[model samples]
Target: MSKIWGRILWPLAGFGSFVLVWYLVAVSGVMPPGQLPRPDEVVGTLATQFRDDDLLLDVRLSVLRVLIGVAVGCSLALPVGFLLAWYTPLRQMFDPLFSFFRALPPIALIPLVIIYLGIGEQARLFILIYAAFFASVVVIYEGIASTDEIYVRAARSMGASEMELFRRVIVPLAVPQVLVAVRVAVGVCWATLVAAELIAAQRGLGASIQDAANFFQIEMVYGGVVLIGLSALVMDRLLAVVMKRAVRWQDRVGG
Candidate 1:
C-alpha cells in the first residue's frame, strides 16, 4: 500500500504542477479569455451548464460505449490472435489484411462508416472496434508468439495434449501481455470514440465540445477537455489496480 501511494504521489505532484502552470498562464493575461478560459472559469461553467443528473448521464453514456466497444474488440481479437499464433497458414492468410487495416486510422473510416451505418451508435461502435481490434490483435499476437517455447516443449514432454498445452501453458504465459494489451486498448478505443462522435451525431463528450465550440462557449469547451483528460486518467489508474492484482504472480516471481 505504501509503495502504491508513493507511485501515485509522484503523478499527483506532477499533475498539481501542471494545474499551477495552467492557472498562471490563464491569470497572466497572455491570452484572451475567448481563447483560453481560466481554470476557475471553466469549473464555474461546468457547474452551471451541467445539471447533476445529465452530467452523470453523459459520463455513463461515454463509458458504456467504451465498454461495449472494447468488449467486442477483445472478444474477436484474442481468439483470432491465438489462432494465428498456433497456425502458421492461418497467420499467413490474415497477417496482410490485419497489417493493412491496422495501419489505417480509425478516423479515416468514420466517413464511410457514417455513410453506411448512418449517424447512429453503430458508427461510433464501429470506430471503437476498429481502434481496439488493431491495437489488441497486435499486442495479443505478439504475446502469443513470445510465449516461452520452453513451457510448450516441457508440456509436450510431460505428455500434455495440444489443447491442454494451449490452455494450461500458453494461455497462462500470455495472460500478462493480454492484460497489458487491454490497458492500451482502453485508451485507443476511447480516443477513437471521440473522433467517431465528432463526425456524426448527438451526445458524447466530443459532441459536447463541438457544440460548445459552435456556440463560442470557450469555458465549456475547456471543461469538456479537462473532464475527458481526467476521465482517462481515472480509468487508467483503475485498470492499473486491476492489472496489479491480475499479474500479482508475475510480480512475485520478479520480486
Candidate 2:
C-alpha cells in the first residue's frame, strides 16, 4: 500500500511543483496580459472544452489518426527490420538511405508531401507513418542484431535447421525488441501529430491548438497543449503496462 502511495504521490508532487512555477510566472507580470493566462484560467478552459462536442470530435479524430498510422507503420517496419538484421548485405545496401531519411525531420518534408500527396488525410497519414516507421525500425534492427550469438551457437550445436533457428530461437528473443519498437513508434507518432495536422486539418487536437493560436486564445492554446500531453501520457502508461506483461521473462537489474 505504501509503495502504491509513493508511486502516485511522487508524480502528483512533480505536477504540483510545475503548476506552482507556472502560477508564479503568470503572476510575475513578465508577459503582457492575455499572453500567459493563469493555471486556473487554463484549467477552466479545459473543463469547458471537455464539454464541447467539437472538442470531443477533435479528440476522437486525433486518436483515430494516431492508431491507424502507428498500426500501419509498425506493421511494415517489423518485417523490414528483421530482414535488415538478418541480411548483412541488405543492411549495408540500405543503411545509408535509412540514415539519411531518419535524420530528415517530418516537418521538413511538409512541402514535398503537400505537393505530392496534397493537403488531405493522405498527407497527414504519410507524415505520421514516416515518423513512426523510422523511429521503430532502428530499434527493431538493433534489438535483433544484438541477440546473443551464444544462443544461436547452442541451437546450431543441437542441429537446429535455419527455419527452426529463426522461428524458435530468434523470434522469441526479438519479441521484447518488437514491443519496444511499438512503444517508440507510438511516441514518435504522437509527437508528430501537430506537424501532420498542419496540412490543412479540419479537426484534431493539433488543429484546435493551431486555430486557438491564430486568434491568440492563450487559455485555449494551453488547454489544447495539456490535452495532448495528457493523452500521450495515458497511452504511454498503457503501453508500459503491456510491455511489462509481454516481456516478463526478460531479466533486468531492478526486477
Candidate 3:
C-alpha cells in the first residue's frame, strides 16, 4: 500500500541523507585522519566485530545491566511516586530532596558509589538505578497528579470508595504515564551506562568502548557507539510497542 511504502521509504530516506552528509564531512578533511571514520569504516568494524564472540558477550552484559536497572528502579519509583501524588504533606516534605538529588548527575556520585559499594557490580547497578529512578519518578508523579479531577469526582459521586476509585479510575488513567516512565527510565539508564561501567566493569559495550579508545582504535570506538545507539533504539521500540498495546483503549488523534 502507499501508506506502508511511505512509512518505509521515509525512514530510509532520512538515514540515506544522514549517511550522505556524514560521508561528505568525512571526506572534507575537517578533522585529523583516523579521528573521524567514514560510515563504511564503522560499519566494517561492526561487521568484523559481529563475527567475533566478544562483541556478543559485551552486548548481552550491557543489555542485562540496563534491564535489571530499569526493572528495579521503576518498581521502586512506582510506590514512591504514588505516595507523593496521593499525599500533599508527603509531596511537600520530599519534593525538595527529590529535586536536589535529581539535579545531581549520576557520574558526579561515582566516587561516593565506588567508596561505599566498591568497584563492583553493585556500584554499577547503583549508578544505573540512581539514574533510572530519578528519571522515572518525576514523570510518574506528574502523570498521576495531572489525572482528570472530573473522573475522580464522578467516581466518588457514584459511591466509589477511595481504594476502588484508585484501582479502577486513577490507575487506569495513569497507565500511559507508567509506561512512559519506563521508557524514560530505559533511556536514562542507557545514557548513564558508560558512567556505570566506569566502576571497573569487565564486560559491556561501554567497557569495550573505553578499551577501544585506550588503544586509539577509532573505528572500534565508532562501532561501539553505533552498537550502543542501535541497542537503545531497539529497546525503546520494544517499549513503544508494549505501550501502544497497554494503552490501546485510550483515545488518541492518530495511529
Candidate 4:
C-alpha cells in the first residue's frame, strides 16, 4: 500500500510543484503579459478549445500521423538494422551513409521532400519516417552488435547453425535495445511532427499551434504544447509496457 501510494503521490507532488512554480513565474512579471500564461489561463483555453474549437480532433490527427510514421519506420528499420549488424561487408558499406543521414534533421529535408512528394500527407510521413528511421537504425544496430559474444560462442559450440544462432540468440538480446530505440524514435517523431504538419495542415495540433501563435493566443499555444508533451509521454509509456512484456525472459537467462 505504501509503495502504491508513493507511486501515486510522488508524480502528483512533482506536477503540483511544477504548476506552482509556473504560476509564480507568471505572476512575477518576468515575461511579457499574455506570453507566459498562468495555469488557470491554460486550463481555460483547453476547456474552450475542447468545447468549441475541436482541439481534440487536432490532437487526434497529430497522434495518428506520429503512429503511422513510427510504425512504418520501425517495420523497415529493424530488419535493415539487423542486416547491417549481421553482415560485416554491408555494415562497412552503409555505415557512413547512415551516419550522414542521421546528422541531417528531418526539418532540414522539408523543402526537398515538398518538392519531391508535394506538401501532403506524403511529406509529413516522409519527415516522420526520416526521424524515426535514422534515430532507430544506429541504436538497433549497436544493440545487436553489442550482444554477448558468449551467447554466440556457446550457440556455435552446440552445433547451432547461423540461422539458429540468430533466431535463438541475437533476436532475444536485441529486442529490448530495439525497443529503447523505438522510445527514442517516438520522441524524434513527435519533435518532427509539427514541422511535418507545417507543410500545409488543415487539421493537427501543430496547425492549431500555428494558428494560435498567428493570433497571439498565448494560452492556446501553451495548451497545444502541453497536449504534445502529454501525448508523447503516453506513447512512451505504452512502449515501456511493450518492452516489459517482450523482455520478460531476461531474468531466466543464466549468464
lDDT of 2 by residue, 135-251 (tens): 889899889988999999999999999999999999999988888888888889889999999999999999999999999888999988888888888887788778778778776
- Per residue, candidate 4 scores C-alpha lDDT tens digits across 84-181 of 99998999999999999999988889889889999888888889988999999999998898788999999999999999999989988887878888
Candidate 3 accuracy as TM-score: 0.96
Error of 4 at 42 (Å): 0.5
- Predicted candidate 1 versus true structure: per-residue lDDT over 219-241, tens digit per residue: 87888888777787788788888
TM-score attained by model 4 = 0.95
Cα lDDT for residue 148, candidate 3: 84
**lDDT of model number 2:** 0.89
Show the colliding residue pairs in model 2.
none
In model 2, what is the error at residue 53, expressed in angstroms? 4.9
The candidate, 1 or 4, that scores higher on lDDT is 4
Clash pairs, model 3 backbone: none
Displacement of residue 156 (Cα, Å) in model 1 is 1.2
Off by over 4 Å in 3: 5-7, 253-255
Clashes of 4: 0
